[model samples]
Target: MAGARVDPPVHGDPATLGGYELIGRLASGGMGRIYLARSAEGQLVAVKTLLAEGVVSDVERRRFAREVELAQRIDSAFTARVRDADPQAELPWMAIDYIAAPPLSELVRTAGVLPASAVQWLAAGTAEALVTLHGEGIIHRDLKPQNILLPLPGPRVIDFGISHANDLTRTSLTLGTIAFTSPEQARGEPSTEASDVYSLGATLFHLALGRPPYRADSDTLGLLAQVQRGQLDLDGLPKELTALIRPCLAVDPGRRPVPAEMLARFRQSLAGLPVSQGGRRWLPQRWTDLIGAYERHGRDLARGAGIGAGATAEGITVDQRTGMVPPPEPTRVYTQERERAERERAERERAERERAERERAERERAEKERVERERALLAQERLREREWQQELERRKAENKDRERAEEKARERAARARARQHASGPSSASAGAASGTSRPSSRPDPARTPPPAPAPSKASSAVVWLVALAVAALLVLWLATWV
Candidate 1:
């Protein structure tokens, strides 16, 4: 299911398989149709079955069986754990852990390349998964983003369609995803653990840069030629990750770093970068919310799976609700061998862990001292920040004070200009203004002042002045009448 709803299965598709009710189709590939099935206990599963109507071929059977065996051998937390299978049935079917979070390719195609910190989380988790796969002696021939499911906890590598186990050589199926295919695989050579490393590097490059280093738009022959030559288009790749990823793309398998080494390298690159597996600091809120919803659904489904709900008097409780036969108990011989191997593995792990613990303690002591120094530096930075804030405030206060002063000075200047205009009123009352109009004298700046009346004349001249003024006023009136 890409989102919440599952697409309805095609008409010809079977309604049920091995008693699991097939509700919808998740995907259809060249090999088979993957159906969304529900167990009798209401638990969901992804069931992969072949696409044969009548007689199934022997080669197809072996290929499907090989996939089931390889998938079952892988018991890693970063992979979708195999649940059930029936290889010899009329239509071979294998069921794996049902997931809803979506493939990394889908996420990237929709949301674009992740940020550096998120890429760190992705690289670290994928390396760890590879470590587990290499430890199990399995090489995932196809390790593209499309085969990776991004859960809230981390990425889960799925679809072991082309995976091969080192110890067992099964059907020689010539299948590979071109975008992430290794050079050796392109050259028709046997893929080794290093080939998986190369594919992982390609996948990480795609995650960090939105597309693989090689051009996917090129035709098949050109693309294969590019892969064979180790030519890359690393335009958008982060410089910091170039060292971590470049070695993986080496032409020689022997030169590439092993899974454990790769994991350590990724950890070192992300040492100071804070990361979380459970949809944290690296991922944005919206993506986290979607993951959270899927996580809740997964939890509910796990509770309802019933395989681990309780124990019966005979052995572990089977889903009796489904009439199908449960997987048979392991024989005593196999169980004894498995127990002995587990004990030996545990002893070796315990010894190695003790040695690691001692080195870790020393590192912690040095880290503690370094943290103290950082704390002091952080305090100094805080003081500097406060000083900057204070400086900004002081500048703001000075600007405000200057503005107020300018306003007061402007008021005083305006008052002085008003007083001067009042003093000059008698002189300006002459008709000289009209005489000066020919030269078009510049207008004086206006001020707040009342126009002064014609100044009172001396008594001797008052009569004559009045008569002249009356004549002027009558002449002005005659012009108005005209």
Candidate 2:
């Protein structure tokens, strides 16, 4: 199908195969045409059959039956699960789950190349499918973009474990399968598990660069020679993808990585990315829109088939209808998924612990700063209190010194007055005894005139000078304090 439209059944197409009604032609190849069909229970499925011209040898016919047997053993979510098949029919046919999605080849052709992360996601899913297929000892000789379906949920690997089986019994490779052939396969060496790895690398190279690994030559032989020589055209591949994809294209099969290794490497590359519902986050919106178109096409086909819009193949069982219980392999897909989930949980817990540590450190720093500020304020207050106490003590000492000076001045004044009184009386008596009293310079006691006490006046002036000196000393002391 190109874009969203499936090709209508041509005049030569069969209307029914293995009791399934053919709705539309999904694709056709050297093997045969794959048709969109519905079962009697109104469940959609894809039926693959061999063309009348393809069944030439008995070995080729047996390969179809062998393909059914091997494909049934593989029950992985990454692979298209087989539901029903009939190798005894004139033209053998097998029915698989109908994936309403676009082929990788079509998506890349219409929407251009995918991003490195999207390419890695695609590689992871394809490698997961390879891990399961190789576990069953099935080598998908044709691991190209056309055989991979890109759905919203995840990629599905289709038409696997049949190419190399057919190659062993056939005369040549299918049309256009040589482009993705490994170097050893190109040299006519028997295909191995590593051969599929090489093809997956080529497919990724195409998705990453919009072209195959060795596209220098248009002819098949020239391309085959380049592949054998390991001449890869990897000019623009992202460096992050090199470590994962480059080894797969190694000329030495021994040097190439197995599917499990590839799966691990690709998953590691995508671990830091966010997950989306249905796992569509890795793909671009344009790519998702195209996928939706394909799903709508399936719904449209269902309506034409007279089935309910929500009809699905969930309840229908191939084992019940065909009595074939496909021996279950080890559950690798769910195991890996569980491991991934555990790793993610551990990572989230680590991130939360780091965040909490940072917050605790910040709170401690803030508390330290607050305590330092309070201590600084207390130190300043103590300094001010000590200064105030010292000032009070100095003021008390100055007041006592001023009071002592005033008391000494008062005592000196009183002694001076007493001495002056005694000297005045003695001087008068001496003058009278010597009989040298000049004519009444001193007033007589009998006379009414006021006594002339000049000596007493001088003593009084001395007492006043002493008091003024003490007053001057007190003024100087108070000025010093101010």
TM-score of each: 0.56, 0.58
Error of 2 at 62 (Å): 2.8
Model 1 TM: 0.56
Return the clash pairs for model 1, or none.
none
Candidate 1 per-residue lDDT, tens place, 1-482, comes to 12433356677788888969886655454556676688888777878887776889998788778778877887887777778999999889987778656567666766667776677677778888888877877777767776777777888776553334443333222212566888898787888889888998888888788777785444445567778788887887888788778888888889988778867866777667655446576776655655665556555434532122131112111111111112332222211354665576588789999989989998999999999999999999999999999999999999999999999999997997677665565544453765653421223335333444455657649888889999999999999999
lDDT of 1: 0.68
Worst 10 residues of 2 by lDDT: 315-324
Best by TM-score: 2
Model 2 local distance difference test score: 0.73
Winning candidate number (lDDT): 2
